[model samples]
Target: MTPLVELSGAGFAYEDGPPVLRGVDLALREGRALALLGRNGSGKTTLMRLLSGGLRPASGVLSLDGVPVSYDRAGLTRLRTSVQLVVQDPDDQLFAASVEQDVSFGPMNLGLPREEVRARVEAALAALDITHLRDRPTHLLSFGQRKRAAIAGAVAMRPRVLILDEPTAGLDPDGQERLLDTLGVLSGTTVVMATHDVDLAVRWADDAAVLTPAGLRLGPAADLLCDPELLTAAGLRQAWSPAVTAFLRAHGLLAPGAPGPRTPQALTELLGGRPHP
Candidate 1:
């Protein structure tokens, strides 16, 4: 299947600066939740920017559904219509006075009719579970609400691919859980998030892409997160899932090949009926 988005041998660097990324390849399969994992300066944001038409590749090709993306205005419009990027900071994206206006900004800019823009704004607000905040002042929203507003702005664009940078950052545990729940409800949209949260990646992502000094490695989330050496090389700690799995195996609670739980609740359940060691 053709990737919804693909980068072929892509390499990028700031003007007059050393190469930040070199010879990178990535394919985003439709309908899959992918986690982009890397330490700071590993080119995760650069890769996301390349994918979302925010940056044109300096040395390679970026394609959408098998077609090379053009950097021209019309071409960028075509690309952004299918791909939307929500940056890490909500304040960076939220500028309008009200939530409704902010969310409507993208569709409004697309020359959509008023009714269409209103409809899109409402739908995006509902999708982010912030419909109640529609009329609220954007500046007054809580950090979590602002985050959702930022994402709602992108969702209003109705992109087939949603790229989020550090989606869970600055949220408390409950806020993070709610945001993850909202992400889960985005039924047909393919979600790509760049995050430093290894446990979230292991628990939620279907696929994982890790950037290492060597290059980018892409595979099933379970396969990638379970590899201690790979995580170490990528400058990430092993996620709790694999650590728990290993502990269970050593304790005779799980077979050598038995799959481990992904969440804290599941881990608690797995240890149920057994005395604490």
Candidate 2:
């Protein structure tokens, strides 16, 4: 299948500094979840902005579903409608007085019919499990609720690809789990998330990519999370869950592998039995 989004040899730089992104190439396929992992200032946010067409690449090409994206107003608007980006801070996206209005803003801005906008808002709220928050004041919501509202706004746009920058940041375990479960059920949409949570990436993402001062590298999440050396190189650390380590050691599967755990299911497949004790 053709990729939902593709970036080829993409590079970007602010007015004064060196290029934040250099020769970055990525292809996000439909229904796949890709985790973007790196340390601070590794250009992950720059790459996200480039992908969402918020910033044009200084060189190379960005395409959506095979069509090249240009910097022209129409081209950029089309790209924005197809690829929605959720920023790290929820407050950046939630501007409307009420949650429903905030979620409806995107579709309404697209000139969708009022009824369609309402349906989209309702669906998005339901998808994010924030239907009860529909009439609440956005400013009064907690951090996790604001995050969900932001996500709901993105989903309301009905984009084919969802680009999330640090979706799990600043959330408790329960909040994180809730967001992860919601993201997991969003099928047929290409999801690319830039996050610092190695464990969440290992558990949630199907594939993983790392950005370093050197450049961008792509591989299976399991391989990346398992490799201590690779993690160190990328300015990340292994998310060695106690259950995962015990399972791997009991099954003799911890000898060596790719850098990361990849997924919780990998342990079951490797062990071929219930985890010991």
Candidate 2 lDDT by residue in tens digits, 1-277: 7778899999989999988888999988888899999999889988999889988899999998888987899998989998999999999888999999899888999998899999999889999999999999999999999999999999999988999999888999899989989998888888999988888887888899998777888988767666777678889977765347756666777875433244556565555756544
For model 1, the stretches where C-alpha displacement exceeds 4 angstroms are 273-277
Give each model a TM-score.
0.96, 0.88
Model 1, 1-277: lDDT tens digits are 9999999999999999988999999999888999999999999999999999988899989999999998999999999999999999999999999999889989989999999998998899998999999999999999999999999999999999999999999999999999999999888899999998999998889999999999999999988988999999999999998898889899899987778987777887787844345
Question: RMSD of each candidate?
Answer: 2.0, 4.0
| Error in Å for residue 257 of model 2 | 11
Report lDDT (Cα) of residue 248, candidate 2.
66
Top lDDT hit: 1
Residue 161 CA displacement from its true place in model 2, Å: 0.8
- Candidate 2, superposed: residue stretches over 4 Å from native: 241-247, 250-277
Weakest 10 consecutive residues, lDDT, candidate 1?
A: 268-277
Each model's lDDT comes to: 0.93, 0.86
